[model samples]
Target: MDPPLSFTVPQEDFLLFHQVDRDLYKILVTELSRDPSESMRLLAMWLWLEKVGFHNVVKNIMSLPIILINEIADETMLCLTCLTNNSNTSLTTIMLSSEANDIPLLQSVMENEISLKFFRQNCMEAIHGVEKTRKEVCMRAFGDIMQRAMMRNIAERMVENNNFLFGSTGPINLQFGSVGIAGALGQQHSNNNGGRGGIIPADERTLFVTFSKGYRVEEWEVREFFTMAYGDCIETLFMQETQPNEQPLFGRIIFHKVSTIDMILKGASKVKFSINRKHVWVRKFVPKRTNTDKVILPGETSGFGFGITS
Candidate 1:
């Protein structure tokens, strides 16, 4: 066992391309078994690099120093190949630029195609392997890679898909249970069902539902519509219209307003309602105990996924 490197190396380049320099790899492997102190220290540094979009920052740390070097060589070759293929179009542009402003043209057209591919390939592998991570240490490293990968993939796909729905839709949409029922009507309803057992109060129930096409609902008729839908008044129904919020559950929902109906009627076809707000938080009177048995947790339901509220 050898001593570990004293200082941490920033892996911005390696993170994007998992290309650990030869000297760096040697240090990681030598420190891995010799002394856990140095190994852990360097490991922390490596993990930080991974989180910040440095893919395969530990590429040099393998079964052995020699094997590590061999893997780097293999990866370098693969990356070079990917770069070479990608460069063909740029190379053609370069050749055409001889009669034009070659400097600017070259700068704009040429990039390290091989390095980019190598980084993407290795980084994606590490990211996808996140499911195998058991420890928090490993999880952080994998998380960084995955975040970068997803961002890149989504950005690239957006460009490729050419989904330019600008101004055509608002960034967010808002919805809420109808508040048309006055306090008097609400009290009357409660009085009528006062002592009825199992009759949930009108204000204590909320429905997680979508609005009709062409509108973002602000005030709904509790007595006529939602009362029947929820079967009672409830506080706080996590309603998601358009698409469900995926993380950090319990936030306002934002959507666009595609259109509005003075009176929503049935038989609306292919109606488009643009999102008006990104998130809308609506408060309601929910019963003491909400039902979780019917609400499936994420990963438990086939397509519904999990929900803390559920």
Candidate 2:
């Protein structure tokens, strides 16, 4: 193993396409391995890059050495290719002009968790195969990546918690709980049932279900509806409607097991339950991107073989 670089790394073009950059790869492995939340770190770093639009900043190489580097072989552009061979996403962009509102990155790529995870895993693997380092900045950058990642995780969790509606009136949503009972009703129901017996609460055990083109769905029927159609695959602990007692079509459900939702959906985004000649859909809620036509680059729909759904 080469000794860690004590001083600043020179602005040398090391990341070249069709070539392995050993030092950079090692840095990715050591830092990512040392940190338990490596996945989050990778996610946060990429999200930040996406927010700022990486291609725009790469014109100034040192601007984002962690992502795009102005390395030797490609003098005209910075290197953004994934280190590992599996990734189809090219880190760099073609004809990247400084002035542009559009990110040009495939929205589908960003939205699909699997694609992003695969890309990050590839980068880490190529990095794992590497031996050691040649730059102080690279080490510092790695630390920064973890810091931002951890912070992002904290922020995401904090935001999802039901603190905001603690003292105020709010609509019941997946973030809240099961059945049309939101604040006081849910507690009352649990008390009436002698507490949530044999029920477990986990973040992974929650699923957002929506009913479309169906009769006004009632919160009371959610459990039975899923049970009859899905064959009681798992015990449903509770349900809370997004709109309480207004015949709301969507709600959040709590299952006894974390895998219950997946087992029911069977890899599909939605399950169309035929109820009274109506269509009821339950899916993993993916927030819709507004003004998608402007954000997603044109003529870039070819790389969406990863089953990315809206």
Shift of residue 85 alpha carbon in model 2, Å: 24
Q: List model 1 lDDT by residue over 31-116, tens digit each.
A: 21112223333444344435546555454233222322222333333333332354476544433333221221111112312233
Candidate 2, after superposition: displacement of residue 187 in Å? Answer: 18
What would you estimate as the lDDT of candidate 2? 0.36
lDDT of 1 at 203: 33
- Segments in model 2 whose C-alpha atoms lie over 4 Å from true places: 1-201, 230-245, 285-310
Reference-based lDDT, each prediction = 0.30, 0.36
Error of 2 at 268 (Å): 1.9
The most accurate candidate by TM-score is 2
